[model samples]
Target: MKKRTRINVLLAEQPIGETVVVKGWVKSFRNNQFISLNDGSCFDSLQIVVDRDDVEEKILKQITPGAALGVKGKLIESRGKGQSVEIDAEDVIVYGPANPETYPLQPKKHSKEFLREIAHLRFRTNTFGAIFRIRHAISYAIHQFFNEQKFYYLHTPIITASDAEGAGEMFRVTTLDLDNTPKTEDGKIDFKKDFFERETHLTVSGQLEAELGALALGQVYTFGPTFRAENSNTSRHLAEFWMVEPEVAFADLEENMDLAEKMLKYIITYTLVNCSQDLQFLNDQLEKEESQKPKNERSAMSLLDRLQFCVDYDFARITYTEAIDILKKSKPNKKKKFNYIIEEWGADLQSEHERYLVEKHFKKPVILYDYPKNIKAFYMKVNEDGKTVRAMDILFPGIGEIIGGSQREENIDILLDRMKEMNIPEEELYWYLDIRKYGSCPHSGYGLGFERMVQFVTGMGNIRDVIPFPRTPGNAAF
Candidate 1:
């Protein structure tokens, strides 16, 4: 028989009662009797039962956890003790042995914090592997949803000169000599002398470029890395993260919200169907971390059923004014904890308020619109109220502000005047101004943080734990 190497046989029908070869890193080893290996092919564990007299004496040390090995075996029906199937070895070949003294992983469970420190090795763990696999599945689902809807995927530039949302939270990029940085006559550092011949930074959002594409292609989305210089050390914050920005030409605020809701639902359902094993693993191993509930006791369907209900039901839409009014007059019900706090107009809603609004008040995902113009981005269309802008934030039960979208200020005169009012240099954005002069249509778009969506789907707490290599303020660990 030729050398056979297979990681997993779980996908095959009736894998047992026949001969097969197994190859993988040993996940765990027993006292010369049994071993488990994860070949990184499937979520299910493959069992390698070793009888004391069946293997060469050299095989003892080689069959340890983290060791690479291949076993040519008779595929016999499993006794169904540890697993559904077993491989009765006919020949064993040791590829490499991971030193038990140095390897961090063993049969014992490791904490997420400890695992995060060794990102390179963490993927070997069952939990991280499951999360990442689901992450990939979710990404595929997003593309599938858009592709089915005929939306084009547009590649946005990483290095952009525009502030995009005017959020000042940007990582500046420069190539001038560090020792003798160029300065203007007034002693201020001159950005004009930089490598780009002007100041530039990694994009904080892809909306601007996405808008350009949307204006041309009618509907487009940019899925790429977005950087922010904010020093927030919260579970939800990341210095560098990926964003999915979709802009639709001639789309208004209502249509934009509808698209967002449908997209989120589609992703949830997709992950549930494709990565059910991984998500179940995450829920059993990690999701209970939220409330100390055992995974087996909970039958959570990745909250897909809840979102399906949302798809069938109309999303609760409320104006900012109405939200404030409800908050001011409401009693402390289960869904209105924030109602007990001070309620006032023009005050930025806290995460607690957002959660309360969606979880307690609406008991579903809620869309709140028409934020005070001064508190909203300058690009947002001003409402008829003159004080509120056409801004919308979609808040989910556990994930607040999952999507932020708004209609653009299409009137060039008003937009230019708004820029001037904000003291923005019009000369820097002359090309952007030309878009308005060249027949701009009323457009809308939103930015959904990719990792944030994963968190909501996988129920992962920290954004750092969700991404493969998380980049945060002053922290970039391998």
Candidate 2:
């Protein structure tokens, strides 16, 4: 017998009347006659028609939801209304049996919170399956976009001696026992006795290292896992996530924004074209979810429309100072509607402010640049005005600040001064500064949280739902 054909391929190929084998977990078994099977390749499932009399009662009893089954059947037009094709089973094989009463997954609408608790089995659900499929497409498109732009994909180390963000929130990697840590003469825990002979932690961002690659190779990008030890237990934050950072040599802040805008559009367009079915599924799912919300709280646009808008229109570009001015003059700030009012030019724009700019003010994707230097990182290029850095943040509707980047400080003296001002150890980042001292030119890069991007594309409200197994504070199970 020929190997079992994946349900997605079988559904797409629709080889009518061909004898074939189909294998997957049972999604639904109706009256022990019609079996809905899914192999995870697509959102739709193949219907396996089982002859109630032909198949033994014992075998039929095992064809419950979540049970893995292999079926030898003939491809035929589905008599069902929703599906066009299905399979007529000749032989049924139970690879794995799942007790319907004991299985966590049943044919019903499960809450996102409950699904998260059983994340290991949530992949079988249509909602999560669709979200992850779109997530995969977005990730794939990121690589494709960078590759097409001739940017070399560079792999940066996960363990680093330098805190790239200067945030001091990094997961430490150590071999020393916590209970018996070695102590120096100063009575402090000695990192010299630990692994790598130095204190190291998981990387916060690959932008710093990718800058090194860009300086040498002209252009480079990194798509990898990043860690944050921040104890944020919110829908938007994840302890461990993926980031896409791209750096370009001889590029300034404007070019940086253009690249980011283009890359986002490319990835989004790619997902829209390639994953239409999945997107549609997610779009409908989102609409249903929104239907339960108050009429005033519903989104102005549907998921598909929101994604298409991102692709069809140009993102509005404004300076941070200009944005602050706009916010101050806007009704929200004037009426004290903002949670963190924009009363000054130097305060960091919170997510509420960003969403206001994108959703209320511009009504489109917006890229705000020239951030106040005091609020940004030390690596950003200080502007000619002496107050703001050459930093830019791309804000999207519904999801604010999807991309953050800046032109790097190319001058060694200025970079060193900023590092000192930020209290970052100069000795630890000596190698990073060497690039500036040796042969630095104008360079820029940005970091896009991969899950946030996925959430934006899929219309998933929670960042945890977009990632397969989200790592967050107090939750690391499976």
Candidate 3:
């Protein structure tokens, strides 16, 4: 029983004339003499050459697309033009056979909508394989970036009684039977009898818990799954996604911005160096996709160029007030082209506005800080002018807000007033307020939606494509 070598390693090592064992699913069986095999190790597939005359008819018949096979072969220089090296199979073992008549995936192009329906099997496709590989690289870069900065990785609770974003869009975690639900004396559904003994929901963000860790430990980060119950069925929204949040004590808004900018550049640069092949494939994929669009709708820069731009240039920084003023006078708003028209000073910016700031006005990544107090969360530090908060959002070219953060309010009196004004109950988050009472300093943190980052890096248009088993509105299949 010879050990199998991954295609990626074999491709890189190029063990020419050496007998190697490889096991993978057959991507295609062409001309009964070649097998395009892949094991999802990388974007490229190994061409396995078969001797039609020597191979058994039954074994050859089983080499259909999607069939799993183990092959003992000699690695040699490829005779074909597409690949550099190939395998000359000496022995073939069929682990499983996929019937060509019933197999959903064939050797052809499939629509993204169709692929979403069969997401469990979509990973075998080249496009998704590249996406997921780059996804892994980006994820690794995130941890490595933080670890090098001496930040502690903290595991935050998935279920909590408090909503950190104050967005009121959270999935409730309950063990109570809904068919015959428990009720209180006032006829309201009683959550006190539930599993946690009170109301608790799947956490929408782990920033609050990470903040606690930061206040005590000086610096900390959390990487975990977060859920939202928002019914947004858009290209950018997801019901469940991963988040990367870093919190630093004794840090102000400027330090927070620096941390975010540095981290993003590091991650992008790491991916460019470590995952060059996968990035190139995805870049070509985006180029092909963009070619189908109208000339006016095409992106000015390619995917690789856009990523390099992020790493090469400094992110343009401006206050939220300045951003609002720019948007108000921009041709999109003045000419009635924006979907959400920016008509006032206090209005929240939409994705279109953010994209404009990045792609048109700044021509690079943009950071807009000091948001209006009323539109932001309750925990942000109130500015001296009393009308705004020390909040910031990092906007990218294709994606709107990739990261949103704030200098947390350490003053218990101000925090309580903001919470009350925002209708956030203090009793619900008493422990959060207690941190301020004890020894809270000027702590700041930001959350990067891991899937959104993956989407941005991989040039994926739909957020659903980047995440495996995407949990979107009304669609949780596999």
Candidate 4:
């Protein structure tokens, strides 16, 4: 016979009366007669019925929780209330032993903090298994949504000289010897002796390079890992994360918003249809988690309902100035509840403001556009008012500002002037300017932080819980 049939396949196929091989780690053993086994194939575990008379007591004692087991069994209709089928073991083999005293994972509820420390072993748990499975479904949905629209998936560079975000928070990639570094006569560190011959770092965003492809190929998107060296230890921030950036030629800010809204809906709907079981499990888990909180602190809607709410209603659209006006008159700003007071039109919005707009005021996703140019990047198109840019940010209920992007300034003269005002060297971005120099038409793009989206969709409180191996300020443990 084949090595073993995965529990997911066995549960779905239900090949009754046939002798099959099942191999997995034991979740629980009840009375030495019923064994619950999980193989990471699905969130549900397979129940293995062991006849106490057939198996020796010494061998049966080894089948403790976390022990690896292989069993030759026959599938039959289960008499259990919840499950439909189970395996009747004929023979059993212990692949490994997990002593109850030594094993870190006990057959009980473990805190997420504890699980984070043991991330390598956390995948075996039902909650994490459901999260990752849903993550996979969302990732596939992203590619499918773009592919259906004839968008080319662009692979942007992982290392480059340009600081795409212009934020100066980057992890340097240098091979120079720190102990005996080379210096010029001016006492400046000589980058000529470095590996790239100039300063280079891990990419912060792939939007710039994706634009190059979009201008040539008509439409393109880049989904890849991005790095940030900010020393933020908060639950909302990560040192390293994944991003999905899509660029389109001959498109404006309105078209970009439309694309983003459609894409989000598609992914949410796809997960609901394809990963129903996982979503249901996560929904129940979230409900139990929230039940412990104060009544006022609990979420108004469930996980599945929140997802469906996103798909059901259109995102509210407003200008940054309009949002400021709304906030300035709101109770939070008037009562001095906002951390950052909304007294001026050009002040940047904070998380509290964003949450109020999404969760309390509008009670839906909101897209705030035409932000002040000084608050946005240099690439955004300058509005007719000269003080604002064609920048847009999509704010979600739990996750603030999930997507941020703008229409590119296609005019070569304006682009160069903005670069000069921002003190960005023209020579370094010669390739980027060339796109505007030759046959430049209107183009727009936006970037979505993948992990933040996962947190929003899964109702996960901490961003670290959504990603498999979260890289935080002082934590990189596998």
Best by lDDT: 3
Model 4 per-residue lDDT tens digits across residues 386-458: 9999999999999889999999999999888888889888999999999998899999999999999999888
TM-score of each: 0.91, 0.99, 0.98, 0.98
What is residue 191's positional error in candidate 2, in angstroms? 1.4
Candidate 2: global Cα-lDDT? Answer: 0.92
Candidate 2 deviant stretches above 4 angstroms: none
The alpha-carbon lDDT assigned to residue 438 of candidate 2 equals: 91
Candidate 1 overall lDDT versus native: 0.81
Candidate 3 residue-wise lDDT at 472: 88
Best-to-worst ranking by lDDT: 3, 4, 2, 1
Q: What lDDT score belongs to each candidate, Candidate 1 first?
A: 0.81, 0.92, 0.93, 0.92
lDDT of candidate 1 at residue 74, scale 0 to 100: 69
lDDT (10s digit) by residue, model 2, range 1-478: 4797887888788999999998889999998799999989999998889998789999999989999998998899988788999888999999999988899999998999999999999999999888888888998999988889999999999999889999999999999999899999999989999979998999999888899899999999999999999999989999999999999999999899999999999989999998898999889988988999999999999999999999999999999889989989999899998898888878888999999999988999999999889989999999888998999999998889899999999999999899889999888988899998898899999999899999999888899999989899998989
lDDT of 1 by residue, 350-389 (tens): 7777877877678788899999888888788888778998
Residue pairs in candidate 1 whose N, alpha carbon or C atoms collide under 3 angstroms: 19-75, 335-360
Go through the candidates in order and give the clash count of each. 2, 0, 0, 0
Better of 1 and 4 by lDDT: 4
Report lDDT (Cα) of residue 91, candidate 4: 92
> Residue 274 of model 1: what lDDT?
84
Q: Roughly what TM-score does model 2 have, to 2 decimal places?
A: 0.99
| Candidate 3 clashing pairs, residues 3+ apart or interchain | none
